[model samples]
Target: MAISASVSLVMTLAFLLASCGGMGTHRGTPLELTIAHINDHHSHLEALPDQIVRIGGVDTQVELGGFTRLASAFRSYEGRDNVLRLHAGDASTGTLYYTLFKGRADADMMNTICFDAMAVGNHEFDDGDAQLKSFIEQLHTGPCKTPVLSANVHPQRGTPLAPQNAEDYIQPYAIKNIRGIPVGIIGITIKRKTQDSSSPLPSTSFEDETSAAQRTIDQLKARGIRHIVLLTHQGYQADKAMATKLSDVDVIIGGDSHTLLGNFSKQRHLPKSAGPYPTRVANRDGKPVCVGQAWEFSKAMGEMNVSFNAEGDVTSCTGQASLIIGDRFKRKDAAGKWVAVDPATPQKIAAEAATDASLKMLAEDAIASNVLRSYSSQTEKMQKESIGEASQALCLVRTPGESFNASGEVAGCEEANQRAHGSDVTQLVAQSFLRTSLRADLALHNAGGVRIPVPAGAITLGQAFALMPFNNVLIELPVTGEQIIAVLEDAVSSYLDAGRSSGGGHPYAAGLRWHLDMSQPKGRRFSRLETKDRQSGTWASLDPARTYIVATHEFLARGQGGYASFKPIYDSGNYVNTHFLYTQAFVDYVRAHGKVQRPAPADYSHQAVTTQAGVVLH
Candidate 1:
């Protein structure tokens, strides 16, 4: 919460007051609107765990982000004119709070906070359409039903969503009064991501993103709604691109990609910047459009001031992406230098040192605190209950392949040789998926899903949830040998060209084996590609004509996370949803095999064919 530059405490109030006839008619002077936004809350209802941040280039741990701080930050603008509170979605999944309560806790919190409207994020459909509808229906059960919007999603006729849409629970756009002005807020979720990567029902379909947005804008403008805000679940870059294309959108409050949009140069405690706050881009008519998005996990809240002229064009806009961090630990001296304390220092000063952290948790907003305590107490209890026990520490890491990242991760052959070929945890999870697969030839897993590393101790439900947090379903897609090889190459493409693919689609598998040469061309990197025979469990060379049932999660099976080769099956509706959660498979695997020990290190079946590169690194 270090402010490199001083921002007005009464910024929202100032904008509101100035909007209410500071001089003359609205036509003569610009009409002002204040938008307070949050996105990617991810069910982090209570205060987040203490995290380390670079403060003035020094690592410092501070307790940051919670529902209370967000509420407190917005409380200042209560009852103010020309002000709207909007959320850009992703208010689901992350912690034990979501695991125990589904989205009820999040609904309750957002119900109380009472956003004017919210976009439908991709993760909202993680539990399927019915659960998402149920979660939305649970919101406070009062007049304060937040407008849930997604213009591109068109639920088929006779579907639950279609009927509800006719009932007004889901709509393309909403018009709210900002002071006396009617401002149209259109919400759009990323169509492709939600369609392919999430668990939306089969009947739920998506239209082109750019088309949906423009159509909605035309519809709104036809109704004489000029001041428009697009609350979008699209990433920051997409928003910028939309700004350049759209003719009517005055402001965009965006989410997804969990991007931080602001100047963090002076604010050491805040996240690094992706771009400037209110990233300005010209619309189709070459007029400026303002785009603003807060960072993820409720760590920050965005305040954007937009002034519109009589023609409904933006005159001026300012966005403050403020990190809602609590006051904790100590600060540097007046000269801005961190002073190290000596062992012989006086008792009083030493007691007040950063090491002591004398000032524990900072004060939180009363209303937010009350709500958080109610649900947090139950979640905490659920988090502590033991789920299983590990025989030994199973080291969990995202990347286990070292040679694939030689430039960054490997200093020499020794370093590359020392790294594990594959993560025991991911491979274990893949094996679990295979065990649960009805009759798949093999099972595959992406490294990104393996979140928290397991320590040697009793594994709790919370720990397991943390490990595989996403509510991804198990799916087995039918693919030909060539398609499988294409995706395998796609998975390793990032490794082949690290500059283009930092997180190359690394795959961990069970009932399958392959040797890869990183130095070869992207498509030719893999060799000895094999899958286990379902009946005899014998590794056999992939047959080009054979139709293999490849077990994978919904995300990857839909060709997300760099596995575009599987997308053909998904697009053609040739995959089967095993109706099992990904984590449950791992849980079953652990329970079946009691007291799992630290796995023996295994060598990579694949490595860079150094000679193929025609060069040598010292």
Candidate 2:
């Protein structure tokens, strides 16, 4: 009986690792490797609408980072030898590009640059194993094949990723014969976070990332592969720790935290960098090990130059991560349509009035031309298709609350209008749910769930989806009025204790109103709680003991992101999905009420402070 091909592939790699004891023959040459990497791209195929950059000390709007600039960066390294391009993880989710086309649009773009090797991101499992398997196949449809890797992943028996199809795509490590010297690239992904956050099946399992890296590094070294690079999605801080944990790993190219590295002080107006490029950490043996992360959303590309001694130990590491941006392109308004750059600005890259014309000229190469263009052409048309209209701009505002301080006394709010009020976006989404679900007494939604503002204009399907990108379903659950109050308290109290950045965990809701007093104790801040009277459309005090059916998204119902108060409700099995996509519900609700108008400006909450001492959020 002959052994299977899958068996052979697995056994051969294992045998190569298992049987080897000593260093193999060739000492060859002092190797130089240039690795270009990006992670958490989130299917941002083009320059994102919200990317802001400072030009000539002027807060200028420009196209900053897209596939075009990344393509140019890769092309710049053409004549260099032993060069490899890597994407750490998360090549999915976030935009209409992924929503309409799914991973196909992302796969088409990946094939454009054809990364040498990529780690499996948690978002890759958003559609489950079958989709990830399909994406792997699609990614290889190019002149050269790009290997996908994830060393910590172990799919249980009877799963799609079980031995049957797994061997064809995912690999533990890839050995590249660079400059006659073997360089091993190992992949590691976030373990528990992947299981908790995404849609991976129950049978699939993840090992500890540090432990997995050590095992893989040992195997690679056993086979006499010297220069090992750990390509990971475990985030920046963990990458720093892994340097001390893994002895043989010379460099860690990382992702998942979306951490920006390198100096950005020169580039004012950009978000501050997390640390220096290739943030150096000492290994267990006290040897220098370098780590780098390109900022997320393909806004930047990581460039690292590493030199190794003849013995395979790294001698020196250098190079900085750079932002990818364009000098010329159209700008977008808050509502996210392609609009011309401001005419009043002193400097304009292109003098012509930006028209509703082809942006296909931005496509600089074959990948953008043959692949991205086709998808762009269709989606662009769909983006312009009118869904409905809004009467006025529903601005996404974030204002620090009066009493919310790092010391945990004040319960601050993230957003406000003329009054220290809550966000309109959150309130609008909550209201839409109530309109669609008639039985609900209250509607609640997270402020972050709505990514963008709804500009007062013709709303398009593109804009609607952008505002709500998560695939959360509308869900309704039964809870006492007391529980609802506790939820609101928990939303603010937890963030205040942690001094959370963007700590605006304050929830917004419709069919309800409440007053928040910063001077009061944490749990006692909310007062004058009221619910809408369905009969008269007037406010009525909420009775603490009375039960009410509340509408919220599946994300909230699942008790995720500091919503553990809802976990008991989730465990009660009383909650049920309304079988409507939350984002689509907004569209349906808006269409049902022709010409959607901003809800009347009314204070949902009030804030007051007694202390004269200045409070600043840590």
Candidate 3:
């Protein structure tokens, strides 16, 4: 009887152990939550580089980053006591994949990866509000269930923030229960008004980021949520400012900046204090905080492991940002021979083991898939397509101090001129169009407007579309010759400042070449300025009183390129879509002359030029 009774007791204890994770004091211990995160995927669905990374002194080989490989990794962590998968933002742009599918394939892939929540990036609005609404509908109605959250965006007067599923579309915050501890997440986006005009953000207003975050944090605290994570589309400096100002925030998983934080040491800037304050401040409950972010694309995943006490306060934390390199990749060495290798463990491993067959198959599939073939295939299928031709092979490369007039000079012209524009490829195209269409004295376009390099080959209609993606119209403005000189001086100053120049040493211009003094303040860079008339073929001194017709893109004419002085230059009636004109010109030129000759530099005389205190050039 005693032996039988003991067996029954043992059976009952075993049942309890299996049901409640093995009894004792372990039941009350705070759960360990592991969060795996990535941000700014930007439609890179292919497997990235796989490398062995060192995290907290532990070397672990991360082999893949495709949605499938990420799926496998998620499955491995499934059934763990606590785990969450998340992405920061900016998953909607940057590649042929995004351009083709308009974020459908990306949504499907992200759904497969099982993302719990995502912040809306500025690019999410690139296709306009209606498309963004459709994307939201697909996410909500699709097989995968996840919430797209943005706290600051408020719809303009008539447009709805979200017409369908308006109730469940977005929330200021979400609370997740992990082992009896509640984790609160707050989502915010950068103010769209401050963004570049190229971004297709709706006319809706976005609240100030810092204020919005503080209000949300206060609300979360009111609900008794102690642990907070801010999922923000604001850039790195903004995130740091939020972290320092708001002590309630526990961890900031941010995007938009595309910053890579590989380890905790790389995140030394966190726990920063505000202003003159030295010591790190604490939340209302008094807890230290951490901030982290992953670089853009599927190139990496960020992992942060934090231990909290019974009070739901973080005690210790370790972070690792793992880079995802594709498998079976062969890199050339100094001798230029392809060799089998492991980037992490370079010494010894089987050649077969080094190659990941699955990843290789994926790369092959991406290349073979029709979706990846051209960036416009899917886009054209969705909208009414138009056919156009290119007259000139629009080349996108620009050399420093090069101007648009170089094209005319290259075609052979003398030093006689009446306007000042620099030599650059885009400037050349703009100048050619101005002279051919409107007979303008000077032509101008913002350096930022020219996006990609127009490859010297068969210029497809789609290629032209991509080159001038932004639908901006051309406008002719009337400005004094002095104002034109001022604009040229600004461009020259930008050329000398390594940080300000967009195309490295290259600063775009249309008419003239003048020496710049790097040592002086920006406005004083020009030491010599001269121009030549196109028809007269004789050199002329610039008449400060003469009103010159300047052709420029609409954005610059509106004073966007830091050229506030140009705002006073009123626009003339000869306005046309710059893209349309360029397309027509390119098509005509290409059709007429099978080959487009490259523009060469012009020889112009500038007398002795010198800067303040005798910094001279001849």
Candidate 4:
């Protein structure tokens, strides 16, 4: 009584079909399935530079990623047997494309890529609930509509947190048939408690992932579906723990952790199987459970091939996580259509690509492209190209003191400079978009939000966009003299005293400067606070009682980056997306002044004050 190959395939397919209520099956005949996935794209709609990414000791050049190339690759996967295209999360934010388009272009790009489904990452809420709803609306109404799933989000008691028009656009779980095999897909969102408060999820909350996943798994089991797949926005550690606890789950397609799982490894509590498996650990059901993820951006696509038995459980699987590099070559057809040839081949790269071509093209054209280009063209048309020049050179450098400061003051200082550029750049572009609608003001950016440094050169619109990638709204909040001191104290205690150094150290100030006494207790670090109104030209004491309209990134006003005290003073009325606003401001400033100058040495002065710890010094 030997099992025939066709019989086994038929049984597996039957089980899979039964699991999904006979909705659909894979396109191929071999009964083989391949899942191609990307995560944390963050709207990096460009082809990046090539770089060496070391994976399994094989060094290769990965030319980086672009949405256009990704679309081509995804289309190639179509008409193939058992191919699934998906994204893990963080599809919006972190790049210029998102900043200029407010996620509309990214959504279009995703539609072109034909993503089957995506989990909701934390950054999806960076624009807040209202914007998120709008994005959902667009996706629902768009031509290339895909399912979005999240089991953890709970609506508020009164308000319609989930949009009515987009209800069908989102689901907690989906069951699909792949090559006659029933596969259950479950989506999970990140817990808001662990994320920064700046996430734009008002009146909504997240549930416990493990509990929510357990319920979904049980529901799928009741439906007779056994081949389970989890599309999760939770990070790697959480995924590992969930796998250990939830034995019924077969495969966990994860994001948010951004770990490069080049090959399948064994699970902790799972057992050894009779054949080769993707993971080291086996589940209680004796099925080989696998976990996979593709790092942020469309830099790479993850592929996993799994083989199941008559029971519809994964038995053995072999696959490699492949990174897709974007390369374009111009060629002519017989009829002379001037087609764009894609040079992306599935090769093992030693490093990821550094350049993003899609972004570069957008920069060069600045109009025909998506939102950023449109904004740039508008700015140029209005002759808004320059902002106030640097009085002196402000370059990001790491000093030794950065290692010792509580807030990583040195790092904070350097990052502040970086963020100033990022914020200024984003603000300039955003301002350009809304030139006719709103009046521009001094661009203010939070040091904590700046993730990278601004390279010195003829700063392109793209360069500024990379620095201030988060599409945070600009907020003009009025804080009394007492609130101002409280905010400064919060910055010192959380940033200076608390040893969390980002970038270099020391918080960078664009239009303000002050001296701090580190030895003083947490709330008493700022010994002197001063601000120079660009108009006044003279340093003025920050009155504790008088309210002043301060421009800041929305993240800071919402008490993100450890500045919880400022939350109370957050003014929702004056909030606007600074992406176009600031860019326009910079363009106007630069055009008016021709060549800008960095601030002079005298513009910024600092001295460490003595405290109980010692004569604090930097």
Candidate 5:
């Protein structure tokens, strides 16, 4: 009996990697391989709102990054030979797509692209091993049969990932054939981060990253696979560091820090790149290792073309990370609102996109779009359910007195920033966190986490999701009042120095207040710090020696976004994972209150602000 085409396709890339041996090949056969990859899609299946990017030397707005657009981009490389389509990880747990449908929606969208392999990101364990197992099952239902790879992870017997003594649910590596050249792609998840921060099974354990990786590499080399690629979920910096520690690691595609790498000198409006695309570093043997990462939220895809000699050593690697965007154009109107531009604007933009190496203009792939449409309809129906109402328009501002969305999304937002208090929405979110966790004395929130302003009208589940878009859970940390002051200083000094996003690092809190003097040095920048007693509702000066429980999201608690003081405390095993979803906390708060309004002036986190230029807003 003859094998069908589908069966042949599956057989061509041998999945029986453990038992495979070397095959005869031409010694001098040079190869050019193109790797198409994405990371940290985080269930953002739909297109994001209008984003401002530099187009034609002007800031132009366009919709960016959807799975449908990614599907189209990946399909564009079909005609090319020796191509590998990969996803680094964190494909689930962010938007309503993951919350309502779980991993099924993410699986459906991923099946559209049919990735060759995917790494195991820490967020995959957010709901435990059973949910991840279910997701992997859905991913396997399609013809791709993409292998889930994580070298260091070991599931104990009877765990969901290792049920009934089965060990094939997640493999250490996968073998792929590129034009008769057998290559090994290994997966390495961040070890300690997953165990400490995420909800993995207690019995399941992860090995030290460097040791496990080297063991896997040696095994592949023994099987005569020389071209090695590591699909890792560790942060970009960690990936670069790990590259130097290992041998035979020719290329690394990574995720988890959401670090954007590549030069965007022409596209000045895009977020700054952390490093050059394909950042080259020397391996242990002084050989080269190329590292690349696409930005978060499906905004970009990385294409790295590696040229190899007969020995399978990478001679050169080059490519660009292109921002996937739609042709539809929008620009700020006279009223400062984002509105559709003239029809000719898109054509002109598309013309420029043709020449721009960093931008790729594309429309949603029809098949992927159709697949998303069914789930999107369900999402829409559920999101429309009313939760509560806002008594007034709560302006969205990152920093007090900074003109962000003043006349645009929220009318009269200009007046909202006239005072020293920062974002009303952010403070409200902090209050929700504190309220949800009764053990905490204060709630701290990053301004960037809260996405949109609250209009003075009905608030729906969709609006709540829009408010807190990340999959961050609430955690309580016990720290001295002194550490609280220092953490706030760290947050302010991070962006105050320059060349950073100020709004995202700005801190907002409930049951706490502070007077900030931006003109002062880092430690001296904050003064008049006070804490409110929950029972008496009386404010008193924060005692630097006193221990206090602080409520914050997992991101900040992990020392991200310049909250350096929180990490050590969290690592000390003195912290509590409340396991309360942030968005759900807001929903619960709204349901309990029936309506929401801005906190009183005395309760605002930012009691006063003295700008760097000596202007005070009070």
Candidate 6:
């Protein structure tokens, strides 16, 4: 193992502390722990192939991530003492695997690692509590019996989650005895975001995150557990702030927001990381709290090692996240087609890649590979059946003019967001909803609902499923023009003003157009509001008093993701659910319409945009 200078310093301190026999009792029985963790795998059990990564300052295509490689990494520490394996959260949704098997496949793959404990992410309830229950049951069926936890969730007595007993399904925390010392791992899920954006039963409720975490910490303290680790599904920024608000939380392994926390300066293929790995924050008691999160989609794993004093205060913390990869390499030919490199290049690339601390080259684990093979055989056939074709790739952008997806991954559509319009893929989804609902005059959709960009060529059944993987249904509501403007403002403020820049609340709509100015306050960002005439194909100014039927997914219509105006209209008995699956509606739209193409400029929802800095995007 190549030990960096910092690692050497940490090791020296560990040795001296060990020699001092508990550091003279100010530290108590000093404990040193190793944690291997991953988060937001999101059902991506198979490795992503043909990904371009920079090795030795050269662009080389290779396979990256997957449960197989993650399993291999975890198994490497099998005989090591005081080592803990954990998965932060978000083990389901976002791919064909979840679409077809509904988290069963995810559970099988997750059991490969046999995590000590897994936090309950919001997407676990996408199919409702019953489905979550089934997935949890499968997770426990294996030998691991990993605890599924959420401290803030409160299930109703008769609900599927708590029908018999809440403890039977979910736990508030797990106690892991490492080397004769009991360590408390408390789980905290995002309270508001889960209740708003997911499909939890209305009868079930959630407690505030801070209060729940504090209360749980008190309970765990009463049990005499000194070392505390908060395994949270809260965003990275939120977790850092949470540390300052609480005491005795020595470490946090978090998910949600899919944050990449590491020094990726040498990894050119990856985006700019959020921060340094094992980000250190000060807790309420002024003690150091180590916080870390792995990037999403099974791409990377975070390994953190922490040493505590006898008093359970974090004395030292060190570690880094490694991007998992294989040795196979590819490069684009002169004709712009991807072709495998010469056989000799693989070893050379691997030798050079080994120098970078963040890159790990490991072959897939045999047991995990076999488990994934059983489920992938069915998805392969489903992926092959073509549902539609696209003449040009559709760009996936959440906020207009933001830098995400601007990489070469989208091909010719790299500059798509440089224009005023936001997401081409989400706009197409909204259009599909509008076309399917004859009674609706407009369709609205959240940018986060659409997963990936569409490549030009034959679109398969699996591609459609992957693009719209949530278990959402189409709904229609008669909302006034004023309500439409209010919702748009709400969506914009949710991300811009409220700091959810991770892109869940930004709105994209069909049959509606507006000029957006972020410099304006709430309810004033949208101007020049217009609605298209279904009959004449002409745009007309919207009237605040006129009621228009709008089509959208059930998630948004339920007032989730900043669409608060729609909830009242839905509760007033003025809404109708088409019950048609949103993904199926997209497939039907493709069949009815010949081929997919980028929407015409006039049909775009964002006619213009002005940034908070007063810069305009035309």
Top candidate, metric TM-score: 6
lDDT of each: 0.72, 0.72, 0.54, 0.56, 0.84, 0.87
Q: List the candidates ranked by lDDT, beginning with the highest.
A: 6, 5, 2, 1, 4, 3
Q: Which order, best to worst by TM-score?
A: 6, 2, 5, 1, 3, 4
| TM-score per candidate, chains pooled | 0.74, 0.77, 0.63, 0.63, 0.76, 0.92
Model 1: per-residue lDDT, tens digit, 165-191? 543456888888766677889889887
lDDT for position 305 in model 1: 93
Backbone clashes for every candidate come to 3, 4, 35, 87, 0, 3
For model 5, residues 1-618, the per-residue Cα lDDT tens digits are 356877986667665442465443434678898999999998888887667677888678888899999999999988766999999999977677887887899999999998999999988987778988999999998798999999999999788999876455889999888888887899999886676446688798899888989999999887777889999998887888899999988999999877778877887555457889989999998899999999878889999999998777889999989899998888888998778888767788789878888898898999999999989999997778999999988888777766334323354564665568878888999999999999899999987677678878889997788678667899999989989998999888766764333346789999999998888888999999999999999999999999999999988898766677888998887889988889999999988999899989999999999877778996
TM-score of 1: 0.74
Model 2, span 55-112: residue lDDT tens: 4333445566788667766776777668989999999877788888778888888777
How many clashing pairs does model 6 include?
A: 3
| Residue pairs with clashing backbones, model 2 | 399-414, 399-415, 403-410, 404-410
| Root-mean-square deviation of candidate 1 | 10.2
Better of 2 and 4 by TM-score: 2
> 1 or 6: which has the higher TM-score?
6
Number of clashes in model 4? 87
Which candidate gets the maximum lDDT versus the true structure? Answer: 6
RMSD of each: 10.2, 8.6, 11.7, 10.8, 8.4, 7.4
Supply the TM-score for candidate 3. Answer: 0.63
In Å, residue 37's CA in model 3 sits off its true spot by 2.4
Question: Where does candidate 2 have its weakest 10-residue lDDT segment?
Answer: 352-361
Query: Over the stretch 334-415, how does candidate 6's per-residue lDDT look in tens digits?
Result: 8977899888788888898999888889999999999999998988998889888888888888888765453336566757
Model 3 scores a C-alpha lDDT of 0.54
